[model samples]
Target: MTYCVGMMLDRGLVLMSDTRTNSGVDNISTFRKMYHWELPGERIITIMTAGNLATTQAVISQLEERNKAPSERHNSLLEAPTMFKVASIVGNLLQDIIEERATDNGQKAAAGTFSASMIVAGQIKGMEPRLFLIYPEGNFIEASFDTPFFQIGETKYGRPILIRGYERDMSFESAIKLMTVSFDSTLKANLSVGLPLDLLVIERDHFTPRHERRIEASDPYFAAVSTSWSEALRNALDGLPDYRMDPAVKEILG
Candidate 1:
């Protein structure tokens, strides 16, 4: 299992993903789940995947191969005219890979098994930055004002922080802090999602990544963020109004 998040903000977009895959407790391994394609001032695309490692890797490899080929189908990421089209290409490729693999193995493909989901975010020249969550069925939905972020894998533990703190117009610094809090929540609850996290920030209309960093286990900044967030949460919880039962209710309970 893994955890990946893509947040849409007025400043641009923020993406993060963990780098761990395991079939069993004893069969753990490390593999990057984030992939990016850049065309300098023309376009920039980042994809973070979660699901079967083999399936996701195959989909990415195929997309890269198509970009290298001389095909005219506009299947290449570089050839995509809009961020939406780029997401469509990726979603279709992922669906096809899962289907082909399932057929080869003589098993029926279902949404829960071979299917993989991805978060695609970036911008093309002359377009605004966009973020999408592509499902395993070759379908996707874009992030909007009402829902400004998307998360995959072990999402439950991390969702509350985003729900309470996210803003579409937040500064990049605040967005990163909120995302770090979300990630810390998931890391504490799910052992399957381990670190060495990949984080990418794309500025609006830049058509290129503004910042990218890898947060390892010993990163000082992440460490401080984690510590501070936990303390803040503890303090907030301590300050909540205490339960006070009415006299009649208390007497009944006694």
Candidate 2:
């Protein structure tokens, strides 16, 4: 399992993903789940994948090959005129790859054994920044004002922080901080999701990544944030009012 989040804000976009994958308790490995494509001053796209490792890797490999071909291909993400088109291409590719794998494996392989999902986020020149959650069925939905962020894979453990703190106009710094806090909660709650996170930030209209960092287990800043968040939660709980029983009920019980 893995966790990836993409936020669309007034400042641009923020994306983060964990690098953990495991088939069983004894079979664990780390693989970078975030893939980026940029055509400086023209377009930028970042995709964070989760689910069946084989399906996701194959989808990314095909996309990369098309993008690197000598001639621009219509299916290439870089050739898409708008972010919406880019998403369509990706979704279709994912669906195709998954179906092909299933076909080769014969009829008994279970319907969703190799299912995967992706979070696509970035900007295309002349268009507003966008974020999308692409599912295994080749369908996707974009983030709106009411839902300014999208999270895929192992999402339940960390959704509360985003729901409580996300703002449309938050500064990039604040967005990144909020993301880290949410990720910390997941890290503590799930052994399947571990350290060495990939972080990327895109400034509005820049058509390129503004901030990028690989946060390892030993990163000082992440360590500080994790500690601070735990302390804050403890303090908040301590400050809450305790339950009080009615005097009559207390006397009766006594």
Candidate 3:
């Protein structure tokens, strides 16, 4: 299991993902689930993945290989004309990989063992920044005014925070803070989604990342945000009006 989120804001985009991957409680490992490709002043693309590790790795590797080899320019992420086309290319590659894996193993296509999903966010020269949620079936949906964020993997635990706090016009700092709270909530509820977390922030019209970092277990900012969020939740709960017994029930009991 893992947790990955891509948030669309007026400023640009913010993406974060957990590093923990586990076969069991005793066989956990850390693997990066966030990747980015860039062509300075032309375009920048970021992808956060969740699901079968092998399938995700295969998809990423193929993209990287195509990116490096000039002969594969037709399918290269760097050569994609628009963010929408880039999302389509990635979705198709992801779906094909899962299907190929399933068939090679003599199982039905997209069997549970070979399924994965991705969030693709990026901007191309002369185009608006876009974000997409790509599923294992080669179809995807873009983020818009109605749905400005996408979450994949172990999503239930952290979605409430995003739903309650996200704003389309919020500043980048506020967005990152909100994401930290969301990730902290999930970390407390699920062991399969542990840190260190990879974070990438892409500013509007900027073909490169505005900020990128990995938040380790001991990162002061992360620790402070986690502690602060926990305290805030408790205080909010305490401040809410308490439940009272019905007068009729009290009289009957008396």
After superposition, the stretches of candidate 2 with alpha carbons farther than 4 Å from their true spots are 66-75, 247-254
Order of candidates by lDDT, top first? 3, 2, 1
How do the residues 177-199 of candidate 2 rate in per-residue lDDT, one tens digit apiece? 99999999999999999899999
1 or 3, greater by lDDT: 3
- Alpha-carbon lDDT, every model: 0.88, 0.91, 0.92
Each candidate's TM vs. the true structure? Answer: 0.91, 0.92, 0.92
lDDT of 1 by residue, 1-254 (tens): 89999999988999999998989878888899999989898889999999988889988888877546556334388888888999999999998988887777766545456878999999988888899999988899999978889999889999988999998889988898888889999988989998889999999878778889999999998899888987898899999965557887666666
Model 1 TM-score is: 0.91
List model 3 lDDT by residue over 1-254, tens digit each.
99999999999999999999998899999999999988888899999999999999999888877556666544378887788888999999999999888888877644888999999999998999999999999899999969999999999999998999999999999999999999999999999999999999999999999999999999999999988877888999999966659987667666
* Superposition error at 93 for model 3 (Å): 0.8
Pairs that collide in candidate 1 are none
Q: What global local distance difference test value does model 2 have?
A: 0.91
- Candidate 1: regions farther than 4 A off: 66-75, 109-111, 246-254
Candidate with best lDDT: 3
